[model samples]
Target: AEIAGEYLKKGSQVYVEGRIRTRKYQDKDGNERYSTEIIGDRMQMLGARAGSGEPREPAAAKGEAKPAPAKKPAGKFDDLEDDIPF
Candidate 1:
């Protein structure tokens, strides 16, 4: 499960290769307990990352359309002066 979890995300698809194994152990009450799990050997991501509705375009296809830089608000601390107790 750990191997498969690494590739899992919202809206993403994953392929896992593994085998099921069962084991027995003693419980807190001294009763025999059994648990079964898949021991994954490999995992593969099948699609784009989560929250990105569409697949990303190749850098070459993007041409000269670069993303705009984040703009800070005018007068960095002008709005915070009134909120500070000090």
Candidate 2:
């Protein structure tokens, strides 16, 4: 399950819904203390870049790096993905 929050403006004028809980405590010097926090459940991306704009191309598909083909010989180490730093 996901909470979809939409139309969140860039600067302000945003709609928000949440709850505030208080913590009752006593200080070391015998003083009363409390704290409040706001928690949210759902949010949505409504900005121009939120939706699907551009598709992602794999590194091997592009000219970035050559992918190891199935026919290629495997390294002596079993952890192949970890062997490459990039």
Candidate 3:
């Protein structure tokens, strides 16, 4: 939720990479319940924030504009090893 609170505006675009997780807990009446959520590992802000009035480009283009440069990953997983299971 930290990313949502910090960067998720009404109309902003974001690219996220993570896994889905589910948690189980008991309710007030002792009933078991489950909740599923996405645990984001990396998040990238795309385009302008809400109300910024900037134009967004198509994710894929045939021959118009060049691709944007890659950005460095944020601090969270900068030092993580690249032996990801996937």
Candidate No. with top lDDT: 3
lDDT of each: 0.69, 0.53, 0.76
Q: What lDDT does candidate 2 reach at residue 39?
A: 76
Q: Which tens-of-lDDT digit does each residue in 1-86 have in candidate 2?
A: 13332434356232345677889899999999998877765333332334556443322323456755789666776655675667
- Report the error of model 1 at residue 55, Å: 6.6
What's the lDDT of the predicted structure labeled candidate 1?
0.69
RMSD (Cα, Å) of model 2: 13.7
Pairs with steric clashes in candidate 1: none
Alpha carbon lDDT of residue 55, candidate 3?
57
State the lDDT at 14 in candidate 2.
Answer: 29
lDDT of 3: 0.76
- For model 3, how does the per-residue alpha-carbon lDDT over 38-68 read when each residue is reduced to its tens digit? 8888666778646777855435434657768
TM-score of each: 0.45, 0.35, 0.46
Residue range 13-65, candidate 1, lDDT tens digits: 66667899999999999999999988877666666656777764434222467
What RMSD does model 3 have? 15.7
* Top model number, TM-score: 3
